[model samples]
Target chain A: MMLHNALDRYHDRPSSIHDLDPRVKVVVTLLGIFSVLLLPDGAWGAYFLVWCAVLAVALVARLGVGLVLRRSLVALPFALVAITLVFTLPGRTLFTLQLGAWEISASDAGLVRFSSVLVRSWLSVQMAILLVATTRIPDLLHALRHLHVPALLVTILAFMVRYLAVLLDEVTRLLRARQARSAASAQGKAGGSLLWRARVAGNMTGQLFLRSLERSDRIYNAMVARGFRGQYVTINPHRMRRRDWMALGLAFAALTMIQWLGRTLS
Target chain B: MNIALLTRLWEEVVVPRMHIPDGFLSMPVALIFWVITVALLLLAIRKTQQQLGERQIPLMGVMAAFIFAAQMINFPIAGGTSGHLLGGVLAAVMLGPWAGMLVMACVIIVQGLLFQDGGLLVMGANIFNMGLVTAALGSLYHGLAARQSKGVRLVVAGVLAWLSVVAGALFTALQLGFSGTSPFAIVVPAMLGVHMLIGIGEGLITMAALAFVMQVRPDLVAAEAVRTGGGRGWVIVGLVIALFVAVLSPIASADPDGLERVAIDMGFEEVAMTPPYELFPDYVIPFLGETPLSTILAGVIGALVVALVAFAVGRLLRQRAAAA
Candidate 1:
């Protein structure tokens, strides 16, 4: 259920941005991320503009801005890897720490770069979250196909999305079963040595693989019975409208302005 | 340590192996990886189609789903720590390398789009590190022992799985170092240190899963193992290229500092001091004063330790398999 909530973050809101073509949304999101990456480090003015643009897009999509911002915190853990730059980069020292025999200093330049990495990644992830929240998985896959993604790869993606929930359910069931059997220790922890616990999890994984393989065979047979072919056929395909093109143009203009501001301000 | 301090330490140390986000990588670095990823993926698509044909589509898709699900199932490692499966080598052993790569790529792309787990622009790097490299190692190492005894096969899988994680971490650190998000001297050790332990967990899980599958459904692994067994010339070439990169990374780290020294000697101090152009002081181990030699020495020592661990794990898995 938790995984389901994570996967099904899309909101069925009716707004101009929400109604935009999925392909347009996908391309615009990618372009936004690229522009964010291109911005100079410590360019707070440019980053502010980009975040404003993203918030505007969120508003247009009828999604709650606070919720979108909160959801994007998933990127923060990864941003910690850049924290090393705070001490490693050479610049005017803000402070120095004596740890035993070694002296370490944090630099003004390193702090700028580190925070820039965090802000840039945060803005980029917010854009991505907006794209997913506004677009359905099926429509996104269709957009990928229309955008000239390889046919087989698209098909593979389609299958993956379709079965993700089912497989996740199976995984949950497997875990629950393990929990029931796993006796607790005096400290109320799962009673097992490291090796034993690993063996259990690995065995469950193997079982899951076997079931998935056989399930795939059954799925293939059922598809064939229903006159399924090698390629998936869509009943109706989405087409870009005038507003979709207009939205894309607006996004491009905004991203370019943001990048220019970033360069000039930094 | 208090519970809060322990949890904070865990969060800081245990960075995930893949799923690099946006803004971490510079544009040129991201673009270079994108190009490399596209080229390799095109080859993978062609090769998988040639080998497995139409049936691979659904099968690979389901396996991708299975892998995604499997990643959620964490196993205890040591001292209340846990790690989950990446399933790259597992997929490669079950499917061939090309299909395995395709499966891994699909999972990463979906995670990026749906969960915002990785950046769209850097998906290429993620795929290259987590998918392409791991699958290649799977085929190269595990493929060699395809016809060996059951114990031998499991041992190889364990070691290869460990190697794949370390290699993925190394590639990621290289990318981050190149992108200027982190310095090489710092991030390299941090990533490698965490992943060395994580890689052990990877090894144990890989060995356990393979041992299980071999016991319950031997033919599944055997069939694909044979398929990848022959025609290993390309695999060898790939190994050579990987080793070349591994050897060159330290030199690459040292060369810029060397240039900075030369610039200083030539009285171009201001040019060398540009913030973006990082003229870092030469990085060296504390005991070893020189840059390149110390770095290379550290690398060799690290490799030797990893090799020793792999040898021990292999021996342990071999005995377990033989006993079973």
Candidate 2:
């Protein structure tokens, strides 16, 4: 929930990071992800160095460690699943234990693979956290459009972000009504069958969809009344400032230094 | 069966956990998913324009908001791995297939952009696998179910939903397999095998939801108008059969996911690349190295975060709409 609060806090901010063009951020983020993944497996030193570099950027962006840590935990399951490769894998076993019919073994190779995945995942998640923390959802979509992401995709995303709140409110209202009716009914009767309850829930979801469909029609009419066409036009075009270039340059420089150090050290 | 089971599934299983971290997949794989997602979006938009009138705009938005919030309520599953209703099928069942695809596409995009749930580059892949496939397949299943008995309809919806989720995972696995990290022989079986179990939970939830919807709001079933013969039945059946093939696709290799397979194959899975500052080992936990506790803490935290963010965003957008 705190993570959600943090997202809300940054959603409307016009910070320096937020000010950068979405296209630039997309490119930088993509490159950063690619470069991080490209680190040869077992490149622990390089991985740590890259992590520090990303951490530095996060600090500069004014994103707190608490926020980053909270967000990073989102990726932990995948990291754990990936780490299982070390133990489940078959090869020369470093350690083996027997439990009934199953023999659990850990492979040295699997350990290296697990660590490599953890490092890469950590680096990538940090970059993503930084991106979301800095940019507004709408701005990011616009940036994607300018960067040559398909117009249709951008439009779909825009509508999604735009209406996400409305549906949530409707759902909350529906739930409240359902709870009230259910409580009142329960007081009068032993309560409905499981099937009856499920059917009611299904009906609620179905009604929600139907209402949404009608609402979509109304929204379209409103758009047309406002002289809207099918094409989506941005209200404000994102312009990359000199500071954006400087930031990009700094990032590249840091990446280069890490790569150089990694090469020399290895 | 009971409210507790439903609540458990909604709270623990069917929510979008956004588990696969960024930088896990290769660039080529990411690019491929991106391309597929974009293409599907364009097609869905055009289809929406052709099928529905302007009313679809606000409708799509609200549906998206609903999905965003709905994702917060995950249902518990076996083996610590939970599942959530992607709602792609449910959306398609109500809004028509094309419209459902667009709604799902939007949800995934926003999640990637605002929540950082999936990477930007990989958004395309996520959409195609999660949205397009689920919507298309769900629509097909519903069509076939309509032709059969009411009992069969629920069963069909549940099975189709389960298949779609597994298929989506398989597609991702195939993408990773093609990148040369792991061969299909290893990845396909593992990913599909686990997700197959996960899909059972998906099917049960979907079936229950569909059954409830049919009982109360039969009119909302998008296919209701067309199902009374007029050759529409055949079309629906055809679509379902087509989707079956799409989901059962043999394209996926048997390789493990990119990061795990690569790490295992390359021989460097253990070298821990510690972050510069040791602020929190198990970030979601009070202390470091407590994985189970941390994971649970993280899941609860994640669910709350998604719900709040979605609620606040919905309220803000409602205000904007009213003001406009």
Candidate 3:
């Protein structure tokens, strides 16, 4: 695939983590994530364990520490908003500059809850990125199908996986053309006001939609010519091996233990 | 594409796409949305399959890819921030609500799994927030086509598109509030206040798309009649009702003492509960004299000050770091 973007850019490497069956990776990652989420708010010990476990996976996968940390910043902005909750929520108004009924308190409760949310979120995002960075889109789709995601939905994802790059190229072309024309119009009398710019965007979008519709018809004709069936055909089907199950079990046990210990202690 | 366009695309790597990231929603709230989204997707698949036979399936995929690509071409909305095409209303206008929903759901799921724009668990919530809300809003206005002018339909679609984004933001805020991340009263206003400006982009884009399509291929723009399935509309109706209640519950909880007094006076409850296992038990704040109104005022003011300081400090840090 010539198309490349930072998001979902699959990096191929030979390692045990990379070699694990995609289904096993999916289950294990989900286990790790769920445990992180299920850990009672502020169980730092378990959270540390989960982080260490993720680091272990990263080492095995040979994923760069810098790469993982950089990709993980995608969740930061959303997390920042929740961090503000620590300042706003009420419990013990430890110290305050009161303006009538309004006050600012560094509540013990809010601080704990906010940190818990942020840490859990950050860990889960790491697991998510790790799973994507190691696995191919096709393998992920196959895993989803094997896991019995509705075939129709799976097919749509498959198509999306296949055509996303192509459609993006088309959009880029359209955007280039639109921006060029808009630039010319900007030099003219009508002026490129916000509304006008938006209208041009909408027209470009309409053109894209029409083009897509026409391509769909042509693609349908081509498929029908090639004896296209209504249902999706599963390609390269693979069964879980002994190693896959072992990997899954080890992951499940570690996560379960961490979660249970965390809750019990907290 | 030109060099400039390529660089623009490269720069876009820094911006967050409109997909909701994970952990903004709590488990219970996320699970509730997932259940609702799954049910709707199942219904959507059946309806589309029935409406277009097997033909709908391929079209749905194409539509998904189209929307995904189109969303990438964002222009400015405000404050040097830009917004992109949501395409829910556009999809609903182009395809019927069911098929439009199918496309939106596919797009959202792909974004989650492929890009991690939203997490796996909360992917359903993201879809429900954006797709189902769009579908419902589109369906709500589907009846306007009876004797309405193309101009009028275009205008209505434009307004609905704007409103759909607002509705999506509402559900997201509600989910966040339920998660205890923020109070509903605070989150709703904050989410809506930002989205109100963003909604203009949606409105303009939707209106432009509608008018352009109508102009170019007037024959192809078919408006599906909205009157057929009254009972089947329950999903959207239920979602709306749920959203309003979720948005309001925080305010209700804020005045617990007054509400309890009313309950006692009306004899609606046994004055003494066996255990009192309700959500916000003893929510009253005491440092400000333990008054209901005072607590609310505290929350409002605290939220305001936090937001103001956060915005100012964020700008300062960004500028200082950049300058350095």
Candidate 4:
């Protein structure tokens, strides 16, 4: 299946970061990212340290350096938005580039603001990628359930994870069929106009939704027939071990100090 | 438009990406929105669970997955580019508002968790912008779409969908303004202008889908209508917000050049001189202008737009209920 393992990029490992309870890993990753954002803009010291810290985490988790870097590129377009602001910002123009009638100037203040937002998003996503890569989705859902998330929300999330890949495959197949039909039509004539394609897209969406609704109807009926009650129940008896707490506390304290020092020293 | 600027706009401002990334919002502003979103989400969860019962739980998952998958399918816009469905209104049309909100919440949670499509710190803000706000507008639009002539239904659905996207963009500008990261004045007109065009595309897609459902699967929407029998709640919500903004806009705009204050934070509030369309030069970015009258005028215009859209939404919901 082309869609297999497309979303589940989990790297199973027995390393310390990988072995941490998913709850601990989630909490630590959140705290770590929050602290990273809290670091004042232009605090290069804080940003560099956090970057190194996340890299260390990735390393400990047996995640390849290249994978984390590549995954972190998802936020680069957003960073480009910030970078675009650097030229328009009101400040001393550090440099200017003229092309045609346009004068594009990069301001020093704008550069500072842009880079701050850029690094912040970049580093935050890196930590997030590391968290997901090390922890299994099952463990993550179990952790959410253990963390006192409502049963219904947790149940829904469980179903979401289970069927997300399946739905992706279904959609991919649908897309291929659409492409085949479109290409066949194109060979005989020009492809449809924008409106025509939009209607087709809409039809495809309607069809997919109908299929999903029918599928869910069947799934629900089957569950009810199998004597399923109104409650969605899952049993997992995984306690937070001492090592989990220790790891979280130490990481928490270190991140806190890094943020504090970044604010003061900068 | 300069080729460079056009591409930059496409890459940065014109992103089909629904959720805002981290660092665009400051700590306090994000946290405040997060708290509000969390409270709203709790109520939605409670209501959805009550309405859906336990039997409908599996369907929530399927629906969530379906929306997630659909978002990945990008349809071609003009210019060889494409935009995907935000799907909030579509979800509301299929499932009622509260359940729609839950489905949206699930999709966002999955997107953030699995793909990191949005930042974790700003996930709450993302949920608010892309999910909650859209759901509120969708349900309200659904209400307006009720019992009307087919033409009215098409026009209203398309306009409301467009307006919802624009409204989401406006709220995004407000949030960015509140964060002191970007001044409201420049961001408002700029974001609004781009989103207005984006909204038209959104409207077309939504109308097409509505037409499809109207023909083939009225039953799917029937279940949704039964859940959405809450009359005038949407009106009250719209009125309160409009009134609140109209009341507070003056005080908020008391200092005309809030950009100076924002300059201390990051310094990038250049005026967007090449706005594709200027509604009115004076009120383009209302608060930044010289007159409180202009701000209030803009606020009134805003209020009127909300009321009109809300009315359409109310009518739509009533129509759907009657049809079902």
Candidate 5:
């Protein structure tokens, strides 16, 4: 239950962003990300404007700006992999440091590229986090289905999200069982060789797989008894209201203006 | 443990954690992969739909959920480190390749959209590298070892699982290099170095999991369904080889130091200098001028052309085989 809450970060606060059509939200989020991606490296003015737009959306959603900023840090670790660009890209050398025998110099161009990557990914993640926080998972999946993503793929996504909590609970209990059985030393470390621990985890994974499969079978039997077919029926008809269209138009205008600003600034 | 240390451990020590976030790739590179991933996804849908019955849909869905949850079980590795299962190969063996690809795609998509673990635009690359490549290799090797003894099949699964991880990492490195986000010489080695070790964990876990499944619900594993005919097997092999050659061609051309050194050693350097016309001279489009972007563009065009030609040749060979 704690894990479920932890995973589902959606806050049920009534706000303009949450009330927008999920499909429009998905499209606008994607448009924001694409604009961020398309902005040239080192476009500081455009980057600032985009951040402003993102913050504006966060404010509208009533999600604290600090929370979104903190959550966006998840993209940083992966961005660190691009650190090599600082030394490898050709440009005027910014500085040089002696690393044992080799002298490494960071290029000005490389620094710009690397920092822009960090900024772009950071901003993009904020948009994504805001989308997920505002829209419920099922609504988002429905939006995806309506957006012409593959039907089977959408169905599978639906089921996965549906059962993620149940399976995660099962995994939690399994981990608990393992912990109870694991013998702790004076240092409070579980007593096992590396291979033993790996084998134990693998067995648990395998056990989980078997249990999930059997559960699916039972689910299928129950569905069949209820005259369930392969297709899923949508209870609520999704229609984009006037405000949804207005929001979409506003987003496109804003993205265009931001892009134009980027070009003009550069 | 404190939250900071836990977060650090989660970020750093996780093995084979190569979900490419946004802004890491160039626009063209990301768009190309999006095209490739979508094409393959459509194909997977068609193939799975044709073969899968109504009951299998729920099974596929639950199995996707299983892969997501199973990723949480971190197996202890050396030096107090831990690794987790990606489960691409396991899913392929369990649900067969086409359905398995769907499962992996679903997990990657949800991770991107909900968890922000990956970027939305670069998701195509993420799904391609982690989902399509792993499932294809898993099915290829598993189908090859299908009729063998259980021990042999397990060994194949373990080795192929390891190979799949390395292969995914290699492609990620290639994509980064092509996008000009990172230099090829550095990123390739770094990515491969980490994944090569992590892959052993993948191998062990895959083997252990397969063995466990074999012992318990023997009927659940779909090894029989994965086995393909001789022609289809050749097509897969041919496509893989073509893909390898296409991916490697640009790198080979870019660094011909070995051949150049050989020419000098043989006293043929002077003789080799004359009569060749300039086509993509120095791997740059002449009109676009000398820039990294132009070189990357030229390289993409070159790779695409080679892959297309090889695909045509393979298609012709397949047609001939069918005619015979």
Candidate 6:
């Protein structure tokens, strides 16, 4: 996937949700994840509620239903793995099928477990997607810093996000160069050897590492010249507005309601 | 190695090679792994600062990106399950082991946090399994092998890559066993059997990658060369062994993995969870199933959207900073 294009989408006008303080968003997202994960494994109803709540949040945030569904799809594999357990699990078999040497029997408990996993994953992923969609990476980092996350970790994340596109660009360029050279060599010879291709790919990776190191040294030297310090200072401090507090209160209320509903249902 | 020593090393030093994903692990096991991961991450940051100065930041960032991109590409393996290079060991061989660990740790952290690729609580477990164990063990293997012949070093690299996966799988089984999810006897053998095959793929990829690095930019392999006393013979030897292992791996194991085996043996097979709305029961969206196909389509679309969103965010920050 093209890294630059992926990054370019984040620059959209900050939605009302995006305008909220990053801390509020972070807390809400964490709460959403925690609530879903804490649901009992067999609690399919609780999971459905969570799914509905996530959909509601997405709707309020004006995030496209299609987009949220798409993002949640990343968790599909785990869901399938859970589904497999339904047939493989031994219990009062809901249904049985004989295939080759294996007898697959679906269990009611297995289906419940699968449903719970599916619901939990969907809710958690929605929260994450919404959080990332709303908050800029820098704002998120700033929030992380204020939340008492280690400065080094935050700095590392910020830089990694920032430089990812650049690195991708460099790799792409390197690949093109290699492809051109390979095609020329192949034209001269009948076919390119697999051994040679492997060696060439290996060389490119090494070169990339060296280039990255050299770039870092240069960047460091420049920073040093500009009176570099160990840590970076925020240019514009993120202030928590009244709306931010309101958002946080509402999130807490929603979570409390969900927990109460879960208890009542159980 | 003595059996006791081997067991100790496997448990303490090597086994947490980091390939196991979440949902495969129980909650208690995940928590323990998380605790260990956090502790190791704290240690890694401290160690990194001592060895690397300001110059390392950009380098670390670029390397993290490279690893991120590399992970996206998976090569098909046996049993319809695909495998990707863990790359922690490979990264460690080039960068110092600690620095390599730090990079891997960051990648896992981001993957866990952003993509929800792994669970938040179990992130530590994932990090320990993938980053700390693999990098440390791979580095150790390289260090010792380099002392012998270059061919031996390559073989060691390949073998270690395979071993790392086996080690990772075994640790995962132990965690499951310890959590009272599955018995050790069933879990261990099952995990070891499949991972041994997977490890061969890992070994080949790693050795080939390392050999290429050695040939192209000898400087990137400088750290490794220094550790190996600049032995060229051992490097070449290592390359040959890698080729041999790659050709031999297909004939190895032809069975379902440890997790699958335990899943089949224990009635608790239903305990394993998959992501929601996934197309195939495994994560792959079959070229059929409208709901699952749409989901896969959405993922491709979502990835594009995420990339765009991330880029825009970066540009906005840069602009705001410049304006300020």
Q: What TM-score would you report for chain A in candidate 6?
A: 0.86
lDDT of 3 by residue, A202-245 (tens): 88888888888877777677778887787667657678789988
**TM-score for all models, in order of appearance:** 0.86, 0.72, 0.80, 0.84, 0.84, 0.73
DockQ of predictions, in order shown:
0.50, 0.25, 0.31, 0.38, 0.46, 0.14
Candidate 3 per-residue lDDT, tens place, B175-288, comes to 665566765434444565456567778888888977887788876675334322313253345335334534443443354344444434544322211112122112222232
Question: Per-residue lDDT of B198-261 in model 1, one digit per residue for the tens?
Answer: 8878888888888999999988888777775534463564354346445644553444454345
Higher-scoring candidate on TM-score, 2 or 3: 3
Q: How accurate locally, in lDDT, is each candidate?
A: 0.74, 0.60, 0.68, 0.69, 0.74, 0.59
RMSD of 4: 6.7
**Residue-by-residue lDDT tens digits, candidate 4, A140-258:** 88888778877788888877777766776677667667767765444474457778877877777777788888888888898889887765555666778999999988998889889
Report the CAPRI category for model 5.
Answer: acceptable
True contacts kept of 1: 0.69
Ranking 2 against 6 by DockQ, winner: 2
Interface RMSD of each: 5.8, 8.6, 5.9, 7.3, 7.0, 10.2
Q: Which runs in model 2 stand beyond 4 Å of their true positions?
A: A1-5, A11-15, A88-93, A172-200, A221-225, A256-264, B1-19, B49-53, B73-84, B142-155, B172-194, B197-201, B204-324
Candidate 1 residue pairs in clash (backbone atoms < 3 Å): none
Task: Residues B121-230, candidate 6: write the lDDT tens digits.
Answer: 46678787767776665555443454445566676667667656655655555565443333333333444555655666667667777776666665556565464241
Which numbered prediction scores highest in TM-score against the true structure?
1
**lDDT, residue A247, candidate 3:** 89
User: Which tens-of-lDDT digit does each residue in A1-266 have in candidate 6?
Assistant: 22342223643645678688889998888777767666666666666777777777667667767777876665554443345556543456687666544455677866665566566666777777778766777787789899987777777776667666666566556755664664444447422454444445545655666676676677677778888675667886889899989989988887877777777787
Q: Which stretches of candidate 1 lie over 4 Å from their true place?
A: A1-9, A187-190, B1-15, B228-230, B241-324
Best by DockQ: 1
Model 5, B244-307: lDDT tens per residue? 6345534423443343344346543221211111212221122332234333633553564364
Error at B7, model 5, angstroms? 8.1
Clash number for candidate 3: 0
